[model samples]
Target chain A: MNLVFDPAWLPRLGQGVLLTVQLTLYCMGLGAVLGAVLGLVRVYGGGRWSPLYWVASAYIHFFRGTPLLVQLLGIYLGLPTAGILVGPFLAGLLAMTLNTAAYQAEYFRGAIQSVKSGQMMAARALGMSRAQAIGHVIMPQALRLIIPPWSNELIYMLKYSSIVSMTALRPETMDLFGVARSIAARNFRYFEVYILVALFYLAMVLILTVALRWVERRVRIPGLGTPGRGI
Target chain B: MALLRVENLHKRYGHEEVLKGVTLAQDAGETKVVIGPSGTGKSTLLRCINRLTEPDQGRVWLEDTEITSRRTDINRVRAKIGFVFQDFNLFTHLTSLDNVRLGLMKVRGMPRAAATGRAMAELERVGLAAKANAYPAQLSGGQQQRVSIARALAMDPKLILFDEPTSALDPELIGEVLSVMIQLARDGMTMIVVTHEMGFARSVADEIVFMEGGVIVEQGTPDKMFRSPEVPRTGEFLRKISDLYGESR
Candidate 1:
């Protein structure tokens, strides 16, 4: 058997890699904001039976329960029937953002809960309002606790961005996987192309893991949220 | 008028009544020590004074304001009344300096430089000035408690509430925390301390209030309470505590 590698595929793959990075960044940035809000609402929005808590709970359950591909296709194909037209790229981004946010919200909620309740009492005792306490005392500590799970979300989003390439989107929106598929289709070098694309993902995930661990170490509150360390 | 007053405070958790119509008062510059056997509502009484724990019934007054009134701003009230927990409850993520300075900056709205200066002064008062940069976990339990006290003191509250402040500290470390509290007492800060440290009660408390079964069983000068409590149960409980904790130095 003969194997062929094409130099032209490199630039195309680079463009895909760039798109993937852009999509992941947008999803994560927006997801974090939305997730934190949802998480807060779920935890502090009155009680388990309150309307706000119910809505947040339902939203989280709906997104987390459904298949990601179904969500992607629903947003892509279903919106048009309701007089809302979304481009494939927008649909994919929206689906991924909402999906990642639901997962991240749970991570954030758990982190917030993991912080000792005494911290909130102490903050309030210092005259901080509830919002102020959450922003200053609780979030600083909660954000630190979320780092481990959040890193997993980040890496998952990176790989998950590949799901976009499987859809019929504009050529410019093609991510690493799409670029590899097209290259393999034309050259009939599926094995070599997939192997190379897999390596790219491995490298990106490795880099993300290292960066996140560094952040986790730097911001860690010694005994807080660390496994087996009683706070 | 007393600097602090609690009238018929009642609190219940489900079927259990934690505080049953407890009334007390403290003048300015007085140190009132609350001593009791475990689970006798001592901690709940302190918590109610600051409105940290809501009372099922009754009222609290700090100077002129009714703290239990619905119209009162609890946050503002809390800012003026400091609370030190048994576990220190120092903001674990913050350095000792930040813990002390947080309220000064955030609640008091003091400038960073002013807050820093004030915080340092409080830390110095507690003899933890050298450890200001340390996080709560980095400090010994005694040092963390001192930092918590400094954190409260930086606010310059009208009164401070100590809920077993040294209960979580090791025996050897309890003295450091008590010394700080003793100094606060001598310096004439209004305080309510819930503790088993009979020694601290004897040396610093203007009045020692003994609580049992959710009410004040007896209250009088520390000397009177120790030497001759009106209620026989008060004397019995005191003797038992003294035997167990050994007077807390």
Candidate 2:
């Protein structure tokens, strides 16, 4: 297997890496905000029969049950038919953001539920209104609890982002995967180009994991989240 | 008028009736100790006073204001009435000082410095001044309960309800929590404590009320109830508790 390739591809691949990182960060940031709200709605939208709860649940179910490829294609190609034409970058970004938000919402919901009910009772007993109690007592602990799961989501989103390249048909919209595919097609060295692309993802994922683990440790409240560690 | 009043409170959980039209009153600076077997609704009664557990029927009054009324603003009422739970329930994410300070700043709108000072004072009262920066998980069960008490105290509540505050503690650690309650009672804090600690009930309670089957079966001055109870069941329950706990001093 010839490992040698054109040195000129380095800059293009580096640019692809940069774009991939940007896309992941943007989707994650915006997805977290959107997901947190949706998670709250699913948990506190007032029982099974509630219309808002049903709506949120249905949205989550649809995104989770369907294919990411179809979603990207639908937004990129299908939206044009609906007269909502968007460029490849915007379409890919939108598709990934909406998809990740559904997954992140479940993570947020689980994190919130993992918080002991007693905390809410104690907060309410302290004279905090329900909203105040949720914001001050519940969310602080819940956000900490979410670190482990949220980081998992972060890594998943990074890898899953390769799927976004299918929507990026234009040269300017190329992510690491898109750039690699185009280069592989021209050079006909599928093995070498794809292997290098895999390495880029692996490197980025390793860096992210280490960075997020550090964040988890820094924000961790002593004797919280992990049980039996505290008195 | 009574400092706190509960009138014919009723609560039912599916097939079980937890509280069956129980009524009670407490005057300012009075400490009432409630005792009963598990499932007798003593905790439910305490929760009802603060509307933590809504009663199916009946009303609660703090001074003259009806806490059960829909317009009463339960948050304000809860602020004025402190509650210490069986499990301590200290905010696990916060240090002892922040746990105490949160209610003061968030609910009372006290300035941060003032809240800090007040929280430190309350922590000192609980003998936890040095452990102010420690999270609840780092503290012993006794210390955690004390921090929760301090959290309640920082609010300067008109009344405090203790729902088996020491029940969740080890026998050796129970004394530390009881001592704090005894001190609070000595300092003229109005309180209603639910417990099996006969020694605490005898030493500190202004009145001892014994409940069974969701009703107050007997109530009287601690001396009268301890020495000569009118109800046979109250004396029986007391004997059983003393036998199990050896009158927990």
Candidate 3:
């Protein structure tokens, strides 16, 4: 079998890659905000109306337990049966948001807990309300701890967006993998197309990893240092 | 009338009783230092005053208001009382200036500009004006504690509580923080301090209270309590600490 590299396909692959990046960016941003708000309610909302703990707990368990592919299918296909006819783009976005929120909530919860209790008391003694203390004191420190896990979530969501090709709204909204598979099917160039797609993903992951590490360094506290500093 | 009064305060953690019917009083602008052995409730007693650890049963009155049982607004009561921790729980993420300004802006409703100015002044009082933009992690343990003191002072509280403020510091760093405390005492800030620093207790305290086994063992002027002890426990504790340090040195 002869393999021919076509330069024209490169722009199409680039378009697919851009869509994947956009999907991941939107999903991670929305998921992180929702997850953080829910996690805070679970930890600090100390009242009868605060069902956030149970609701967030159940949501996380449900989403994390099932595969992400099934979640996308359920939202895209099953919702229409119940008279909720969301567009394929919206369905894909919603499924990814819910899926990522579950995982990110756990990260945020652990980060929030790592902040010392004395910090909260110090804020309160300074006359800050519970909300002010959490926003000004607790969340800022928690963000430092949350960064590593969040970056992991971002990578996972980026790869996961490929599952959206199963949805019907945008037949042209092919992710890198979907595009590569279609190209292989049409031209019978399986090896070259698959390799190209794999290389693209590897390159994107490398770039993302570098960017995240730079962010981690920028936000790090100086003397207290990272967890394993001097060790 | 005492500026602060604790009447029949009791506290327990599970099976361990920390403060057993402890009662105390401090006059306005008075500096009261509490000294005791570990687990003797000195820290617990101070914490209860600010409701950091709510009491099991008691009445704490800040002047005329019954703080303990009133339920009027604990946050409002807390605003009048500032606490400094041994660990210097300055928010690690915030700069020293933000740490001081947070309560001033959020609790007191002071505008950002005014609060920042007040915070800077407080940092200056603690001799950390130059380090305002630095985070707690960048500072020495001594500097962090000073920032904690500055954060407390920025609230302009009616009284301050210090819980072993120097116990967590290196020996060399202790003097700097204690000196700031001394200055605050000179400025007539009402304070209740639970500390192991006998020199600080002797110099700045208007009254000294000694506690052991969850009760106040003895209390009086530093002259009376340290020089002429009424309780054997007080004398034993002082002698023990002094002998331990003397032998180590």
Candidate 4:
């Protein structure tokens, strides 16, 4: 087996990596907002006609239960069949956002429920409207609780973006995995190209994990410093 | 006219009746202390006053307004009846000052600056002015309870309901909170307190009502109720609680 090291390939890897990061950020931002709204509806929107909760639950079940690659394919290929044509970037964004919202919704629901019932009662006793109590009192504490799950979602979204490579036909928009596949085909050195791509992903994940862990530390409630850790 | 009146109040959880046709009334600026066994519906009665827990059947009147009849605009009545919880249910996310200021601003439509000023005064009254900027989590249980008092007092309500204000406190810390309540009572505040502190009831309450099995078993002036009780249940309860506190000490 012959291994050829190409120094110029670093620049291409960097560009592909940047595109992946951008896609992850966009997906996470949109997904988090949608998931939070849905989560709130599930918890507080009384009565049986909670459309947001039902739609959100179905979306989460469908996306989380299915493979990301299949979801990417369905959105990119299956949508065009229904006369709804979308570009590769838009399709990738849509798929990732939908997938992320499902997982993030569970995170938000858990966080919101963790807040003590006394907090809401206190707000109401203070003459705050139900909406004001949720917005002013419950959500602030819920936001702190949601941070850990959101950080996990961020990393998951980053890894999941790789599945978009299957449908992302445009060269400029192709992510690291797709770029690696094309390079492997040209050089006939599948092992070398794949290994480099794997190394890049490992490095990205390592950096992100450390950054998020630090953020978790900073945002954690003072007395509640990391569950199971001794005072 | 009575400042507050509760008629035929009945609350049931499943088959268990918590408050069984209990009724009471209070004059303006009157202080009433409700004493009862653990599950005799003293807390439930206080909760029903603010609609924190809805009663199965009841009519609660605040002055002329039928609070229980018009359920849609109960916030108006609620604004005039401040409630304090045993657990000092201060919003952990907000500072002590913010907790007090929220009702004034949201319910009374006070300007932010004016609300802050009034909140500061209330905190000062409760001896928590120095800790106004601190979160509930940062404050001790006593301080948190004081902040809860401040939060209720800031609204300048016609009545304040306290549900075991010192029940969830340390022995030494109970004095400070009770002291604040004594001062509020002296200032002619119409307050209903559900408390185990018979000492506080004896000191500050104009009337003491003893509840048992969801009914007011005995009610009279503290001097008559405690020193020379008319009801056997009241004497028994007092003896048991006094023995428990004595043993704890």
Candidate 5:
């Protein structure tokens, strides 16, 4: 038996994609802000002066240690048992944001460390306060180097956001596979529907990679980034 | 009071003392050159003076302001002391013009237009006006060092410290950087330069300080040190460098 046409399901799948896009973007945007703050605290905070270092370290370890599936479930299901209730979509969004933030912070810290120590000294020696130096000189250069890694996180987030759909809540916009499941329940054409959804994900990732590569080309310094080229 | 003073500056790292009781004073418009062998604390002394490297013990004064004192604002003192590094540590991301303009706009709070105008003049002084838009990686070593000098001069510092400014350049490139140093001296910029270029020392330096064993082993005027030095170590050091360069004097 051959798979039949499913034009009726196209609209449902489109809605699912819109939800996925929303979840990915919100998570990434808010995550990046949190991550940047966490990364800076890790890099500049030193012995006995900043207690935030321990907090950042612990956050990264916990989020990165547990699987994202457990995290989503913990927020959606476990919270209700503890008498702390949240809407399904809200729980998923919150979990994805924190999960993404922990990973992104590590990438940012690596990029920040790659910046030459001399850059800070030169700025401070000029009498720019430490904050001003980090803001103007250090962050500008670090931001450039981080593009390649940061975009990787964005791309990763697209796939990572899929776990939100598995939560007990049925967010209409977020469940691409649920659209396939609904179609499968009717026609039992499970393979064809899911394959179509897989194609959509592949296409999205492909487009994202090309766009990010273009940005890297436009902004990269000739000899000051990556290894061996910089001080 | 002297324009800049270092009193018995001392620094140690795990029992290895880098600078021991090093002291010096500079008057305004005076050009002092420090000569020393590698690992002999020449750089440490300069860094301590600017508080770039904190001395384990000592005091530094920039015209009656106790820079090393706990109450003193070190940033203000450092702003007045322009430091030119051996590697020409210009901010790599910015253009030559922006590097010079940074301090004026950020530290001094000058408007962008005024900072740009002053930065241009400083670059022109180093004969690099045409390359203001070039990034540090785009320029030659000599040009990059010159841009670093322009960055320092743009601050209108009370005194400039050159930490082996031309040591990383090629022999031919070294001459261009040295010439700029000489010109700054001629223009009456108070400078304390650390270099091995005997020619620059003899031509432009008011006082030549030879440092060894983390101490000011000898000090004399340029002519006196070069011709009839009182210290055997200073004479031997000069001969060794002259042999390496093959420039008989």
Candidate 6:
């Protein structure tokens, strides 16, 4: 058991972190937008069995019901079968984006529903159309309620991103897990290498948790969900 | 045409009949208060007048427009008909000023600067100008209801429906909201109110309607109704309410 760590491996680890961060962030952006729109469609799309509601409901159910690893492989290998060929990066990004969006949609829908019914009635009474009320009135409050759950999605993606590398993602942008795996295989120090990678992931999650917890504090509605915490 | 007319309004909830064939009319610059037991549909009648709660059978008209018709642009009618709720229903996420300014800017399409000015004016009217930037969650229940009043007033609606606006407030706080309503009544605003505040009904309402068992049992001038209600049910109900709530005006 050679306990000696290598500084030379730092650059490779850094590169993996960059790629993983990029993939997580890009997926988060797409997920936020898609989730909000789809969540609204599910709850406020007028009636049950309406086309928009059904499509959003089905999409959420399908993605949420399946595994991320399976989805990544499906997009990477299965897409080419249907004449929709994409490179590894695109495949990973697309799969993560869709998966994140599905989960985010449910979170957002739950938050939206949690808003008191009086808020909707007030907005409608003030001459706002159903869309306007949901958009301007309901969404603003729901966004605050979503922070805790949405941040959960974010940190989950920070780690769930590791599954992307299993699907032929270019080695250069593979991820910290890949870097650790290669290091362990070459040096026969699987224990030490895996421990280091675990620390790296823990660091990412902690940083994100602090940052998002800060946001949840900033947007805290008084007398609502705030637990008397301050900046 | 009356400023507002509700004809043969009927509403049913599951197995319960909430409002049955209630009809009423009021001209411009009139204030009416509907007083009844909790489940008698006083709130339902006001909500139905604004189409907030669609009536199972009947029609409502604002001036010449048949507001109950499917062809009517509901937003337009709703814009002109303000509704203040028992729970205040202030936009909890927004500040007092934004609550007042939202409909003016968004629905009426007033410019931001103009909306702010108008919103401030209405806030001032309700004596909440200092709290304009304060969120509804930060305000007292009475203050929240005042902000809602300012919100409805900013729209300059043709009619305002107050569905027990002060019912949720403490006895001490009800005065402030009622005073604001008194000022609005004096200013010739057309309003329909549902309230347990018989004092307000006595002072401000041109007509006071006493309802029971899903029907309007009697209606008359406050003086006539308070002194001598035509129906025995109205007198009995009023006596019970006065007994429970200290006294009826």
lDDT of 3 at B173: 92
Per-residue lDDT for A94-213 in model 3, tens only? 999999998888898889999999889888888777888898889988998999899899898888888887773343667677777777778888888888888898898889989999
Clash pairs of candidate 6?
A: none
DockQ of predicted model 5: 0.68
- Over the stretch B1-249, how does candidate 3's per-residue lDDT look in tens digits? 999999988999999999998989998899999988899898889888978889999889999888886565889989889899989998888899988988888889999999989999999999999999998889999999999999888888899999999999998899899999999999999999998888888888999888888888899998888678988878888777666544121
Candidate 4 on A1-231: residue-level lDDT in tens?
A: 678879878787788898888898999999989888877877875635777667767777888899877887898999999999988778899989988888887888899899999999988887778988888888888988888788878888888788878876667888888787777787788898888998988888889889888876776654444567784
* Residue range A74-112, candidate 1, lDDT tens digits: 988899999999886788889999999999999999999
Candidates in order have lDDT scores of 0.91, 0.91, 0.86, 0.86, 0.88, 0.88
Clashing pairs in 3: none
TM-score of chain B of each: 0.98, 0.99, 0.96, 0.96, 0.97, 0.97
Model 4 DockQ vs. reference? 0.54
For candidate 1, please provide the TM-score of chain A on its own. Answer: 0.94
Report residue B39 deviation for candidate 3 (angstroms).
0.3
Provide the TM-score for each candidate, comma-separated. Answer: 0.97, 0.97, 0.94, 0.93, 0.95, 0.96
Give a tens-digit lDDT track for model 5, residues A1-231.
Answer: 687767888888898877777878889889989998888989987743567898898898999999988998989889899999987678878899999899988988998899989898899889888899999999989888888888888888888777766763353735666566777777888888888989988888888889988988888775555566546
- Pull out the clashing pairs in model 2: none
Candidate 6, which segments miss by more than 4 Å at Cα?
A223-231, B247-249
DockQ (CA atoms), all models = 0.74, 0.83, 0.73, 0.54, 0.68, 0.75
How does residue B109 of candidate 1 score in lDDT? 98
Angstrom error at residue B233, model 6: 1.2
- Best of the two (4, 6) by DockQ: 6
Question: Worst ten-residue run, lDDT, model 5 chain B?
Answer: B240-249
- Candidate 1's C-alpha lDDT? 0.91
By DockQ, the candidates rank as: 2, 6, 1, 3, 5, 4
